[model samples]
Target: MAFLVVSRYSPLFAILFVASLAGLHCESPGKSPAFSFRFERFEKNRSLDAVIALYGDAEISDFVVGITRPAVFSSGRVVYRKPVRFLGRNPSFSTYFAFSVSSPDGGEGLAFFLAPSSSPVKESTNGLHFGLPPGATAVKFETRTEPETGSHIRVEVGGEISKQSSNLSNVSLVLHGGEKVHSWVDYDGDSKRFEVRLSKSSDSRPLSPLVSYPIDLSRVLQREEKLVGISSSSGNSTQTSSVYSWSFAVKRGAPYSMHSEPLDPRPFVVRARESPPIHLRRTYPWGVFVAMVFAAACGGLLTFFVMFVWFALIARRPVAPVEYPVHPVEVGYQQIELVAGEKGVDSTKK
Candidate 1:
């Protein structure tokens, strides 16, 4: 009886062992490689793995290290030490971060940027440059007012600070209010669309984004590796920019080349084979395309109008009445025979 029981239970034990092994294999890290991190809070003593305080007044306090200490004319930056790796030709990513800005007076504000690995942290000059390096793409939340555009959220690329595509109402969000604001930044590499959504920390993700634009980042980043970071500048005013939480994740897939043409790792200025910078290339093409489209439309309408008028005139032309010639008929006199007969009758009657 004991031997029979052992044989029957052995098969059940073997099945359970196989199932456990399969579960372990499925959970292995080698099958899926993804870059992701979430930091809800920060401690001064906690060592951040693969995180770097690149430069300037950036330190860990009660929050993550991107927060700048309250000081006038100061700036801070924090970046992930490892460069972002793309597993496919078109890699996508979504990031969410919460920040608050408090200032007694006006503030310069904060920014999130993506740049090439070789870029250096730029210092503020006359409260301008928000620590964004050249060839970087950034979304800036500005608290200070400008002569033309007041406090607004702007998305810029390739170091060109042009007015970005955004809803006008986004200006109502007070950047210096010191209230925690949540921001979501998403990029779809296949569609080349970049979007930004903003809301209060208490609320969930907004249904609509504050700004959305189309951009090909491969042209800007120039390589597979890129540095992602946050920066804030007091800019002649006393300000405190605090980041409470941050999360970032990249989609996983099979690896592929980023661009059709391989790019040289040298600086753009030194690359003789490369084309002109992105700002110059992106700005003119849209204007030229719009102008060409408008001109074609006008020409087509004008040609159509002229052809319609010509046809109408031809159809309504006055036709003259046709005239026929009246030919003359000659009458021959038959007087000789009648005269002879009448002469003979008149001589008899006389």
Candidate 2:
């Protein structure tokens, strides 16, 4: 019993318990670059587990990004469901947005220009079907093995069921394995012009420019009131793909393109006014300090009570006493033996 008690309260076990409690109690900062809606979850489940849905005419400009691949479904559509409208007002300048996906098999990728539709169709494996609403234009970024040659990048534009294939004449942009890509799209209302550019890292030189193409926005969308988002899937042969970050912007100004200034994508510390730190609120820290001290005192009292009970039981148990017998010793003397009773009788008669 003593051994069991000692083992249960070992130093290693105590340390592990305290460490786990600290980790479980620690909190992290909230999401940033606020949006109408934001969701981040694994690919295995199609449900949106973590989401922030905003109200009113607030435009979502920036997003902190991350994604994982070999998703279950090839056509994963994110529809900006109604009651949530985008580009409500006529703006002078074009909107800007970007998307990036990481894939072991970088063979298949697709981007969509979506509209208000009841039902959207899924894309095929290895970038076969570009997931888009009916009557919407889709730009496919395909990196697949050709029958007669090595791997190459091809661009395909589709609307509804019709598709137009175009071989990239300028092979400047090459997406490598496990690379973080930054691509942007600018929609200018004045010129009715749209431009898309993809950027990547360069080992020898500065950041290499992947591909830049001018798109005619007027020709692309059949209707002005359409919802837009990105969708991607994996190949039939068990390849994985993932999308990291996506951002959309809308403002009143001339349509112009600018390279995103490189900044540390690391999380920053922002002190929110409404939700201040608990420690900074009044004398709460002191109160918490007192509460913790009281709890510790109670715990110590409990431990002492248990120990007292244990010792009391040991004290009350019955124990056998040892006995010692004492023997008396006589002084040195000769012992007299009676010869016969007759000798005594004869003496009496005489």
Candidate 3:
């Protein structure tokens, strides 16, 4: 009886075996164009800026990108357009952003990154811990471990002095894959502080910051310009995640709006803000040996602009209103009888 049953179902078992082998054949990560990863702007539906995506092994039938597109069986990355003032020579600056990441059954996890624009993305690697490629600085949220998946912050420059710290309290880094998590990364150069925070509400104050990092913006920002983005990777189990929305803003007076800073729209500048005031480094002529003399002459374009602005802001006194005097009018008809003496004399003489 058992032999008869085995022989009857032999074809079904063979078909299932063939399908499993095919999945393994296409399971190569970071390679193969047929299973290639996608990085692109998410323009339709809910107004998000970008995305990185991949489908399950041999599961590429209906891959979607924008809001309406299902984020099923996808693993991808996305970055913002513009670069803000990360660091500088003299004056320092700070920036803050708000973003949301959603993953139902966490795979590799999400990452927030600040990468130099010059580096190309093709050379990057993928995994839960190393969400970003090698050429950038990143803070990754790892959700694939046993006890408690950890979130880490890291910076790597020219493959030297690379370090990552998970010293943050796990409570602060709490996240769930299916539900949306609201996160914020703040880099305040003025305070010399770097921190990450998450919240349930958009308007809520940062809940005990997940982690705090003390970074010297000047050193971390090797390049003057950098891009803000996110990345994630999954295991063979197959996973998908999406960046719901992202807003990049530089702190101005009274906090700026989401669009306060846009990825540099110009291809060449790439998220660069307005250029800084010009600096003239040329030396003085032989006739003027003193440094002050050279500095006075160096006030070419920038110095003039500063002076113009100063004068323009000065308030001018209001002019006095003009006054016109008003006079009374009198009208009367003169009688001709009183003036007849001269006229009568002329008539009588005639």
Candidate 4:
């Protein structure tokens, strides 16, 4: 009787043990999170429905998000209306945006950033740290050129500016040119690779990134809901910064697509934004020189042909001899030539 009772209950105990193990497996901390949102442009009346809140001087008008006014000490932030769960043991994300910074004199610049949802915005002209909150992780687009760093893009953590992650002194792109500039920022949680790509609205995403720094998001960001947004500020110099479109997505188990479809109508096509390589730049002068030399030779040949044709077919014709017409009186004079000659001879003799 004791052996029978033990056998019957052993099956139930084994089942319970298996179910507990399954529960533990499902809630593993290594699992990645999922969050995605895209903004091609803001609608006129539906700005509030876009799930974004404007703070300070930030405003949305006619499908554009204006982050800051063109006035000194002006600063603003356009952040998500609600906090998002952006943290996992290893969190990865990809984001793309089209922005423009325009003014007579370029302003400080702007940033696409992530911060603790509870952190408050701090307004300051403290260089690249403007409009950022504590414990914020940002990729800043710096337009103002300094003697030491010039124009650059850098990653800032905890509202503190660090050495530029990527230098833009020699790049052809003008951040404050008042034209739409597109940028892509992607991170691989598994590889700890953080990349930043910059281009024009008409250009495609570059093959190579401007900045690819090794960063562990788990260390930089807190394991809580994050507020994702863009921030900008103007110092003594004033500039207008606008966001034409923006898209962001947290990576899942599958590889994230960089060119995912946007929520709104696509703005414009994109070509490659890479600068010409050193070899190509070096060959450009030779190519132009060759073209000019060929053109000059063609012109010289044409001139020579025109001159030859003139001398051969038009300028060397035979000249006609001079002629005098004989009249009736001239004929009579000719008939008396011999008599006249004899008289002249006799006179000379006498």
**Candidate 4: global Cα-lDDT?**
0.67
- Local accuracy of candidate 4 as per-residue lDDT tens digits, 136-167: 88888887766677668878876666437445
Model 2 ranges with Cα > 4 A deviation: 1-73, 82-107, 119-128, 147-173, 201-216, 219-224, 255-350
The candidate that wins on TM-score is 4
Model 1, span 83-117: residue lDDT tens: 88755566677677788888768878888988777
Better of 2 and 3 by TM-score: 3
lDDT digits (tens) for residues 247-314 of candidate 3:
44443111212224332212211132343111112233543444344345444434544554454444
Mind sharing the TM-score for model 4?
A: 0.63
* Candidate 4 residue pairs that clash: 203-271, 204-270, 204-271
The lDDT leader among the candidates is 4
User: Local distance difference test, per candidate?
Assistant: 0.63, 0.40, 0.43, 0.67
In model 2, the clashing pairs are 66-244, 69-241, 70-241, 93-253, 94-187, 123-129, 124-129, 173-210
Q: Identify the superior model by TM-score, candidate 1 or candidate 2.
A: 1
